[model samples]
Target: MPEPIADFYAVIPAGGIGSRLWPLSRADAPKFLHDLTGSGQTLLRDTWDRLEPLSGPDRIAVVTGRAHRAAVERELPGIPDKNVFLESEPRDSTAAIGLAAAILVRREPDVIIGSFAADHVIRPAHLFDWGVRQAIAVAREGYICTLGIQPTEPSIGFGYIKKSSELIVEGAPEAALVERFVEKPDLDTAREYFADRSYLWNAGMFISRADVLLAAIEENRPELHAGLIELAEAWDDRERRGPVVDRVWPTLEKIAIDYSVAEPAAAAGRLAVIPGHFDWDDVGDFASLTKLNSHGRGNDLAILGENARILADTSSGIVVSQTQRVISVIGVKDIVIVDTDDALLVTTSENAQRVKGVVDALKLTGRGDVL
Candidate 1:
């Protein structure tokens, strides 16, 4: 017999413009639609597929911008038309999640909800499923459950979650009470966090019941919660959706769920962190893409380059073009060389974080042709 299906709903936020991954990931097509892992499946498709066993197609909802609706629909055909919630304007993650919570509250008030980013790449599907199951049970108990990745390095790109007391869950690893939430720290601070062994990298994956999340929002950000409740009531009117969403979204403060909700919830003793051992990467910037990319012994992704020497200590390279083109490099190391139909990017690996700078310059110079 097949495994029992878990009763939960999933919310995927895919509203990022992904300027750092330009040329391949553009305004018309975000990074979630691109196959960053070269697994033939886009990141959005991968995320949806991972949640199938837990929630199935009907329980999945995608919250994205109006500009990305068609792309999302084309990528995931299994999702129903009503499940795709579009924002009138681009808002921060807090508002995006508030809209999702409102939608969930309308349909199923007591339902457990899992909110995640659409572009994260996590491996070993079974491990992720297990983590979700544990979180679901915790959420059922009316506590906010967040998946916290065990930090493998003292990297400064991600925020940290400090755990205080341990709560034992039957048939699962120990869940910890979140003592504090720390922002991205410098190298010295990161090393201290690692030495303490009480910190976990905040993966930004959250699970909670609809009412539970609404209550948290109400307690932390009353204005945002009120606006969401109003939108939820007006959503069925059809005529009110456009005007209400337009007016309310701009007025809602632009804050991340971590700062606006999770931190405060932790301080109030309503937060728990589940140990997430899955191989996960947010793939936030171009530098992260390199670490997640597939690279062999010498970290080389060679394409149409004969007698070329490409050496890299890290996984960092992608080459794409329309026609057969002869490209060669000699005695080069630690760089990203992307060759597209109309554009090419050649930058040192260390400068990968500044890839967005190039995109901004292109936009400023009015080079719409390449962009």
Candidate 2:
């Protein structure tokens, strides 16, 4: 295990219903609450485990929706009640992470805060730790740093980061100046980027000094910064916290941290990126879930769940069963069957990305009870 960074504090943004991984992931119980990887641990627990070595259990905090506070607390008993920052509603990543930074800065001014997502999967723990160490080195120098993953394939699922030049930081030798962040592209554009070695997958992992992050937010989104500051002021106050959050939480602008801070910082040459040498996956959809299955690599079928009784003869793909159902596949290929107690989703891996549309249609049809 790598030595813990004394000033480093880790924050996890654990919102999002993960609509793409529907049936298996729901509104009341999001994907982070379940063990999607078949690793016998929920993604939230895995995330806490990953950060514990670096931040220690006490230095880590979690930001989640108000509805999920009890579940998240149940999953992570090591996290203190004070560290579990609950949002009244989903205000996107900017407000969620920014509030944590603002509140943490009040507690410890010189804190180096790293905001990591709660549901992403990263392999070869040592490499991730090293990447974070390097990011911390760069972050201490006052630049907003993000860990960028090397593109293993021309995957359009993730955003790309363009690195301009090498940063001559002492500890972070491979760190580079970020030119800009690009959205998920088409196949041709993704291929072009893959051919060029300057681009990396933006994993949405950011590490920075708490004050520096707040300043960047202040520069780009003054209104949001002001509201967050106001909320942070009353955050620890027992008397004023409740009334203030109820009044100000929903009024804050619902924007991603990428748009609110990262892009602007990149434009101003204040963004740095350290290339990560570890394998990463956001597990966005069932297709991604197929890839994360360790036993499904070369096999015709991959099965998730202890009680899942899937008998596939020649079918190739993934099958997830949350109940005691005997699911059998004959000759279908790339099929995805997610069988839960309340919902059953049957689709192909080709249409896995379109599963979110099903959730949208369900909501439009007033079938949110199943969602």
Candidate 3:
């Protein structure tokens, strides 16, 4: 049985459109709204399911764009209507999360709030819960705590967190004082970091007391903090929320929480990381998605949507076919074929990270229909 955390409030920032997932993930219908895992539920739905059990439905809130409000509501039916925070525009993670922290502070004053991205796919629920519990315990000690993923490979996709030694925080034996945050390193550097025991993948899972988080933002990103505070003060007032947010939200700087708070806070020794050994994937590209599809069960070909529609003959790689179309690949290795009704993408599984370039090309050609 899942018991609610005493003063814990969950904040899920479900804003990204996941341009790399292209035809499957669109602007109106973002990646978070889709079932990328084929787990019978959308990513946002899965995220809500994961957090609701910890914080209880009422204590969990979603911060998303106004454009996605209807979709978010439709997806998470149990979410309180008041808990849906609608942003005027895309202001990135800092603004979205700062807005949530401010609002939670307005109500509970010193509540514990954890911000998790909706698009990530984490497995072995119990392991994730344990790590989050540790993070929460560290957050209660007034540190901006993050759940750092133990790297299984020398993956360059994620930022790395360097740790010197463990903290003496009670109830969090695994928590470590973050030395510094290193950006996504090149292949050589990534390999070096992977070999280093102290380096952990920065999972971007932020847990902190509402007041502590806002104070960090005030010290690091004063401009964003000001706008967020104003928006938060108006948040409880239904009639004033739209007006004040419209006036102030666009003026806030567009920066990630990593830059606005995490790095700076870590420099001041205000950040701690609880190492998470659970299987975690941000699902940033098709290559990772293919790996997820091929997990546990061993098969020659990786099929995401319809296994019946995909036929492979001496072929290996990923195929995402969803148009009731028969896709047959013969003698091709490491090929990635994604078939949608309107747009089809063909690339090697190795070049999956470059899919964002294709999206940019479409934008340059003014192809909004498929974007």
Candidate 4:
């Protein structure tokens, strides 16, 4: 139909503590700041670059903790200083997104907003732009649009979106009405979902008008919405925005957007899933790193390894230092070898999934230096 609105805004939520990619991805330096792919660009920078064309620098906003504001600013220099909204303490995605909605709704009342993670990789900018336009079109019609990726395999690490009958959005050929939102399932359940043909991996990318999202928040989670409204009102007061965000953020209950809002909206038939036909990867943990890097051969060096023979059977392998340090491996397979300047990790690929456990142990044992 008509050309999509040129005044669309984007909000990136980057407040997570990234414990899974420990040692490298620390509390001070989240995964979004790390160059996980060994590409010069960090994940946050990559995402910003991808969204630049659609919303430009001034129109984009990043919601993160005060600890990460400098890093986020460093990653996205093109963004205006006022656009970087900072929370005093760490809050979950729901709070971060709600705060963003509150702030953006004030500036551009009818603006369509797109909320995405700072650490996902979706290739081919053209395809991503197209998908965003379609999502925006659906959102303009008062429907909360979420991008659901076609699962490449049975992945239990990610949540799934069950799609109902196809519905027509303005620009998209076919958009599926979201039937239900499923949490991370067991291996057997994941396989069953894969067999259904209607389930897609929830990409965590959402689009909707500011008012629509606020309405969804009000309907699904009244408490959260009330908190958001209070925060928004306080934010309007110049002296209060800074002090209030710092004071009240940590007190907000930690909940994901899916659990707090998306699931409820889907159940009420207010959510729709748009098929995103593009390469998508959350790069959530080191296991996900190997899966994304499966195309590389011998030249693949993770952290500090040289000429290392790494055969990742199940998307879990070594994360070595790339400082030209030589690390040799022979007859070793299905292992995660992480070499840092201070710490070394050698565990089975299966055990690699428990890196968060190591992070917790480090925290419990008061070894914050390594963490």
TM for every model, in the order presented, reads 0.91, 0.98, 0.97, 0.91
Cα RMSD for candidates in order: 3.3, 0.9, 1.4, 3.3
* Model 3 TM-score, all chains together: 0.97
Candidate 3 wrong stretches, greater than 4 Å? 296-299, 306-308
Q: Count the backbone clashes (under 3 Å) in each candidate.
A: 0, 0, 0, 5
How would you encode candidate 4's per-residue C-alpha lDDT over 108-218 as one tens digit per residue? 789888998998888877788888888888888889999998888888899999999887876877587899999999999999988888999999999988888888878
* Candidates' C-alpha lDDT: 0.80, 0.93, 0.88, 0.79
- For model 4, the stretches where C-alpha displacement exceeds 4 angstroms are 1-5, 296-316, 322-325
What is the lDDT, from 0 to 100, of the residue 369 in candidate 3? 84
Compute the lDDT for candidate 3. Answer: 0.88
* Cα lDDT tens digits for candidate 2, 1-371: 76789999999999999999998999999999989878898999999999999999999999999899999989999889899898999999999999999999999999999999999999988899999999999999999999999998999888999999899898998999999999999999999999998999999999999999999999889999999999999999989999999999999999999998899999999999999999899999999888788354645788899798888898888999999989999998888999999999999888999999999999999999989
Decoy 4 TM-score against native: 0.91
CA lDDT, candidate 2, residue 360: 98
- The better candidate by TM-score, 1 or 2, is 2
- Can you give the lDDT of residue 293 in candidate 3? 79
Which portions of model 2 show Cα errors greater than 4 Å? Answer: 294-296
Identify the leading candidate in terms of TM-score.
Answer: 2
